[model samples]
Target: MRRFFAYLTAFIREDFNLRLYAGTAAFVAAMTAFNYAVDLEDGIIDKHRGEVLRFWLYAGLDAFMYYSVTVFWLLANRQLSILKTARFWLFSLAAIGVLAWWQDYTGYSKVVGLPVFGEIYSFAHYCFSNLSSALTVWVPFAVFYLLVDRQPSHFYGFRPDWLSLKMYGILLLLMVPLIAWASFQPSFLQTYPIYKGWGAARALHWPEWIPAVIFELCYGFDFISTELIFRGFLIIGMMQVVGRGAVLPMVAVYATVHFGKPLGETIGSVFGGYILGVLAYQSRTIWGGIAVHLGVAWLMELGAFLQSFVHSPEK
Candidate 1:
């Protein structure tokens, strides 16, 4: 715990520009407010869901603006030479924009058509959607690491020794009460236990827990891709160009990704993303962030399940 705090403190000491931090915070807050105030993501962007080209364009622009504006702020304040690293800045923003679109893309359903899979389409789609992040985020980044960055180190924070799960476990423990508290909120329950069972368990004549567990596992695995992109790629990969300045921009955009989620969750992502960003910057590994993320997500699932079970009419 002390070690984690030390990492955060050290990063702050090195890169704590009051104007940069304050301006970035104001930007994130304003965007978050605008998004939720009019229900921009769920109401507007998602309304175009399944319209592949349109959805991609909207989401991509949204993500790119958040990231680029934050980076612009950093460059303005720090007077960083953007001309020298223009290629990297463009590539990073474009990749992140495409990633944002891909994360929510519903066009995958067409590929898993019900005509082919019959009653299993729901289950198949659910699992595929959850697990596809590995391919979507990891493959491109891996190729970029090999062909472009060519860093002779572990590919963007995959170094095992740089992570301390014990410390992350402690962080998870601290979050238990918070997750439990969130489970009782009407909004939280509505979105959690993210496994809907989708009637697939009944259709397949299988126990409900089977599909639930499968969905949970696939759901948890998606966070690895998230950590890879946000912490590993954004912080560690971009460190060469932006140094410690990467963390705040990453935090700003990270919060935007959660805009479609509950307001509290979106707000929480800012703090969580920052701490993980700092840790990734200091340790040069993403394993600890993965651990805490997976733990909190699964715990939220467990909390929601227990809450629902206790309130179920069957009970």
Candidate 2:
């Protein structure tokens, strides 16, 4: 815990520019407010879900605007230099665009339509959709790392270190009460546990827990991809270009990506993304972030599950 605070304090002391931080915060707050007010993500971007190019374009532009604007602010303030690294920025934005597109992409619906999968299509589709994030997000970034980054260290924070795990666990423990409180909210319940089973259990004559457990595993895996992208790729990978200035831009865009989620969660992401970005920057490892993320995510699932079970009419 002390170590975590030390890292955060050091980063802030060295990197905290009042104007830049305030400007970025204001930008993020306004963007978040407008997004929720207009239901931008659900009403606007997601409306093009199945239209591959259109969805990609909308999601990509949304992410690009948030990220680019923050970076632009950094540039305007003389905090970042894009002189020779134009290609890196372009590639990074393109990769973020691809990830945004892939995240909500509905192209997999075609596969779910096949008759071979039978009544279990819902279960299969749910699992496949979540699991595919690993491929979509990681593959492009991996290629980028090999071709461009080729950093001498481990692959964007995948290196193992058992020492930090305890700190991460304590962080997760601290989040327990907050997550439990969220579970009782009308909005949180509406979105959480993420797997409705889509009637897969009834159709297949299988226990609901089977599909739920499988879905939870896949859902948890998506967080690994998330940590890799936001904490690992965006913060660590971009640090080479922007130095410690990478954290806020990543936080702004990270919050943007959460627009479709419950409002509180979206708001929480700004803080969460910032903390994880700073920690990742300091430790040069994403494993701790991964642990805390997966732990909090799964805890939310559990809380939602327990809430549902307790409130079920059958009970």
Model 2 segments beyond 4 Å from truth?
52-56, 59-63, 66-73, 76-80, 205-207, 313-315
* Lowest summed lDDT window (length 10), candidate 1: 76-85
Task: List model 1 lDDT by residue over 206-268, tens digit each.
Answer: 999888888888888788888888898888988777677677778877887788887988998
List CA RMSD, all candidates: 2.4, 2.4
Error of 1 at 242 (Å): 1.2
lDDT by residue for model 2 (1-315), tens: 998899899999988777777777877788888988988888877777677655665666556655665575567557555645686566567557656766666766777779976787877888878788766787878887888777798998887877777778788899999999989999889888777778887887888888788788888888898898888888888777777766887888788788888787888898999999998999888999999988988898889989989999999
**What value does the lDDT take at residue 134 in candidate 1?**
68
lDDT of each: 0.79, 0.80
Relative to the unseen true structure, what is the Cα RMSD of model 2?
2.4
Full-model lDDT, candidate 1: 0.79
How much does candidate 2 score in TM-score? Answer: 0.89
- In candidate 2, how many Å is residue 315 off? 4.1
